[model samples]
Target: MLCLTAQSALQGRSDRSAWQYTRADTPGTGSVRWLAVTDHFHGEQVLRIHVVAGPDSPSPGFPLPRAGEVVASPAMQRLFASTPDDQLDDRFPGEVTGTIPVDLLSHPEQLIAVVGGEVPGMFTAAGIATSPDHAFFAFARIIVGIAALVLLVPVAVFVVMASRIAAAQRERRLAALRLVGATRSQTAAIAAVESGIAALAGTFAGWLAYEGLRRVLASSVTYEGFPFHAADVRAPLAALVLVPLLAVLVSVFPLRRNASKLPTAVRALPLAVGIGGLFLVTYTSAAGFDELAALFVISTVVGALVVGPWVCLQVGRLLARARSATTALAARRIEHDPKASFRAASALVFAAFAATYLSGLVSAYGDLPGTGIPPGVVTVFDGRDREIVSDGTMADEERIRTREAIASPNAIINTRREFVLRERRLWDDVESAVHFAVTIVVVVAGCGVAAGAAGGVLERRRSFALLRASGTTLGQLRRVVVLETGVPLVAMTGLGVALGVLTLVATKGPLPTPGFAAVVASGLAVALLVAATPLAVLERASGIDAIRPGTSA
Candidate 1:
């Protein structure tokens, strides 16, 4: 990268002549101003100028233009000649007039080293290089700011989800200890201990993911002139400690609530928590206040614990609604069971996350804008007298008559190549910026689906018992789920694909045809995964006798 930068500088110097001359119109010197001039390009229509002095007077302010300092350009000089007190517009076009070129100007000064390419300097530079650094910094700040803001959603989701999981597992572990003749204190201790262990495990898993991503980023394409700092180990360690601490904090109320409930209430714990959470999520999303929203968000997450049971119930209802001969049997089995449906559909959230994230990623990449650089033109910086060797690649429709002696073929080809490179980078950056957002969306979606399945299972437990009594075979039970799920999966698949395509319109952006197709396909895959839950639920709920009142699995 450094070599390339230096090469570009040297190339610039070869084409442009540098010159240095004292201002003839300084207050103590002669009356004539010594202005610098250079040709605009290969054409003679324009000239660039750098003001070397004011006409026989000192500039008005402190830190004013120095005696030998280059002041303004041709357009600026023309504007300033009349106002004298007027500020110059920074965008003034380049011009050439009096002083010698850079090469000749640097003859007496050893500070200016002659590189094989263009040297980066104010007067000798052109376009963006000649512009102020603050402008570039401002633009970068905006991009970084947007990226950071978008990432917050996922962070919140993770925190909420993790807290719910930790709390639910802690309660179950505590209950098991109580059943074994453990004291209340012993049960609470077990809950805390189990929670701590789980938190530690979760922290480790998060750290691994962070480390993996860091390595991938480090090993991925390096941003040529940019810097990237790797994450600190201490930070990940802190996160591990923090996650568990937070889990303990979030579980306090729930733990208290659970301990006070009767055994019957404990069995309903998952469903109650999930329903409350669902209400909370809905409320928060609707409320639009920070505090209220936070509470709602927390509730929604707690609701996830009940997701497994609820989803089962919903699935049964959906199956029954479809009204096929086998539907009632499938619905009954799923609704009446708790553990059976829970096991099969426990991973619903994971599937949802995969689907949502995949869709977001695909959409982001597909909508990425292309580099629109045209071909066959060279932009030159003719400062002082001579030309800069670092000529810009041309745009399309501009004819280039390349010298046979030149090593590279023509400006047209280079223009096209650079265009492709820029376009690729644009897409990569956009997708990367939105990665965390996509992850969060997927996780949230998955959690919702999982909670729904859980609820469905709990509600349908009685139905499953009835089906068993009716002699519904396990194979038949499984088949019912397949048919039941197949319809919704197909519908969802269609929805996802339609939504993926509609994203272009929603975002008011579209990419090439191939990119669009890729995005739609990913959406379809996600839909199919979401649709497969019923089939899995069937497998777990197949043996319905356990759901019957007189039986135990």
Candidate 2:
């Protein structure tokens, strides 16, 4: 199979260059000059050669037959033709060359009877010729199949999920167009148009990425084995179209539901969609599906987003019940006004999910456990954690001291060598761990900041308007916004760090410096980001009143 496939990639039929000299001139020298032979497509069986002595050398001539090329009489060919493919292997004699000998056939697929040399051991062997085997093609097919399977998850997550979410949003957006004088058919048409545009754009981008990856893989893989073929665009195009259509269909019910609601209730549409989305995700996760892991990850992050406000409200309520005047007032206010409180805090959930997953994945990159927090902390802080860091220093004394500190019981400590990738070195598995906690922590916390910002801006539009009217300068308004978001960002990130530490302790039983630093930094950054969001939004939106009343702020 491979040989057949490799034929296409061969340089083609041409006798490769070789040099030759007459044997007579070099007889005493006993040296052979280079010679070239043409074997255009490697189609030749063998070359029969007669090396005659020149006037200066011996008179006799020597003859040799090429590898896998048999020099058999008519009777021999007829005799071997009857031999089965399996049985012929044991009957073949050694390769026949000139007086001296060398192994000629290297490939397993090229086996054929050996023949023709006048040397004492040389004997003509009967043989038949058949098409050579192909291994390259078969191997390439397997790799292509695996690559296709690997891409399915991304396609489902990005293309399918995006379409569904967009479809849900389209219904409401289109219905709004209808109430404003657009026809129902027109609304649907607009949705179709939107989906088509989105699909096209996404497909184009996906193709570019595919081509880039294909090129990269091609350079690394030898065409003689697994050849690189451009991934078929048809599948991805179909995905773009089908996913969006399904998304649109999914949105139909929600759109209809919201369209029937009075404008007052229309204001609550986001909440309803959010709640339904939550249930949908939960249900989907509970059911097994292809790429279930990715689905769970996405759903968990989204779930966190939708449920954040509710979570905050609940927390506030808990605080209120503790009979602390300040916290109680705040909690009651949050609980009583779901729209305002929930929307603002919704971003926190995004941050939290982002933080957790990012941290988890980054930490997973190494063999070490996560951050150094104990497992018991989860009962208090959920499962958030910090990133790990390495200070590039190892303490032999500290290790000894810690060992001695455990005097109450006998504990065995053994040191083992491990390989780790350095700046210029290759990666290796090692007992000594690299610290990634700090990086993961920071990344996760950053996600929280972004979510918090988006949520705060969305939730406090009216409040911000009021503040602007009440003589709050844009700077002050922005400050207030930041204060609101930053608080939650900090709190959650801090908790995440602690949780990260706890996770490490629970899992790795060690918190290396790198991991510890990552967690601490992550917590601090997220906290600051959370605190900064409201203020930033308020500052930006403060100027919105200057626009036409209906224009987007």
Candidate 3:
């Protein structure tokens, strides 16, 4: 929202001024003429406004009249605009062009709606527009949205894992209340209140963090030319109310699930069929089948949710046939409760797939050369009294005559260079933002994986202690835990990569080989480290008291 507001302010319409003058040589009293020219500078679009002060120009209402004119107000100029440089060209033959009377400049309130002129081929709206300036804004929004979605995966996983950490205690308490004549509904209500309280506390902390971040953003410039204002950092009232409500609901809902009831093969088969159907439609349809493309993405994600655990179970069964006792033990655990394993790792699976898909999308569009205006086409802009040379076919004499006739002149001689620069800047910004978001996502996912692995080990303290008391060595027991996590994680990652590749192929995008390889490698490494950590701690302990019934170690 901050980005959107800044861009909107930069592209809004200006109010009409009675002091405005078009001619550079106007000698009338209380009149000031300004020349605004647009050009590309340092890989960005820049508008340079030159002031032409007359002998009888009006008094500028502020102090330091000619000391670098500003948009909105002096403070805003320091925050949003680049420092003024007097070195830029202001020469116009037979005309006086230098500095405008400051009285003609916009006041603070009017400056918020002051984009100088119309941009070609753009749609306009109340706080939104479709121009080059707005393009950067749109791209920024997309980057932030992707990051938020990726972050949600780890947060959701953490919530579920946290709830389960005290499951034994919760169950015992509920059982006691039941024995004392508590109804099932009453017990469920009590559990809901407990979970809701924790969630509400976390939500409050998150709200405070958001406010601090908002303040920092308002005072800083993120991109080269965009600065956020205090007005841009407003949080919607509805969002503030909804956040805590959502946290409470998510905390209580998962507790009602019946873990023993396995999801049926029939439930997943239809999703596979739907995905295949979408792929076929996309391949067979004519060009510009955007609806089909969107459907394919939705189907693929849903299909992963449905089919992922089945694949994990099959892989576990194959590993169970191995002669190694550690591998067999790991495989049996996964085969016995694949759903639980899948639930713990599903977020990682989704994040990997999203990263791969986005990589391919970027690779497909990022490198194409920009197209230019065709030959033999002359482009001219009407400057009201005279013409302006924008592109093509005009002789040198004609171009010079047109420039001399107009008060504020501009031209576009090389369209190809401008197009290329604009396209390159757009893609560079997008890729940079994506890389940053991906880094954040990977870190969060790694933490969740580690926490889940530790929780799983704690839950199975008795089983691990029994194995350790028997003939099993600590190294063997550790390998078992590693296999338990590593196998399912590797299986899920492979499935995600396959789905990503299929999407790229269907959309006629290039395969991102290096990116896919990196995602897969990193995911496996994180999973291995998470699994090994618990066993490494167990190896140092010299007790078997964890195997005692009804006791927690």
TM-score of every prediction relative to native: 0.43, 0.35, 0.65
TM-score of 2: 0.35
Worst 10 residues of 3 by lDDT: 122-131
RMSD of 3: 8.9
Per-residue lDDT tens digits for candidate 2, residues 258-359, read 212111323334434443444444455545443343544344345444544444445555656655443443355445554443332333333333334334
User: Worst 10-residue stretch by lDDT in candidate 2?
Assistant: 11-20
Q: Whose lDDT is higher: candidate 2's or candidate 3's? A: 3
lDDT of 1 by residue, 1-553 (tens): 1111222222222222222222332223222223322221112112223333333533212111433333332333444355322112211222212222223311111121111111122131111111122354456546544433333333444444444532444566667778889998776565566657777787678677765665444334233211122321113144457667765555544532221211122433543443344444444454644345455334433443344454445555676776666777556655555334443333333233223334455454454334443333443322322222223443112222222102221111122334445455655655543343333343333333333443344335455556756887666655665544343333333333343333323223443244434443454356346534544554454455546564322
> Quick one: best lDDT, which candidate?
3
RMSD of each: 16.1, 21.8, 8.9
Each candidate's lDDT (Cα)? 0.38, 0.36, 0.53
Candidate 1 off by > 4 Å: 1-189, 221-237, 245-321, 325-375, 381-424, 431-466, 475-517, 523-553
Order of candidate numbers by lDDT, starting with the best: 3, 1, 2
Scored against the true structure, residue 162 in model 3 reaches a CA lDDT of: 55
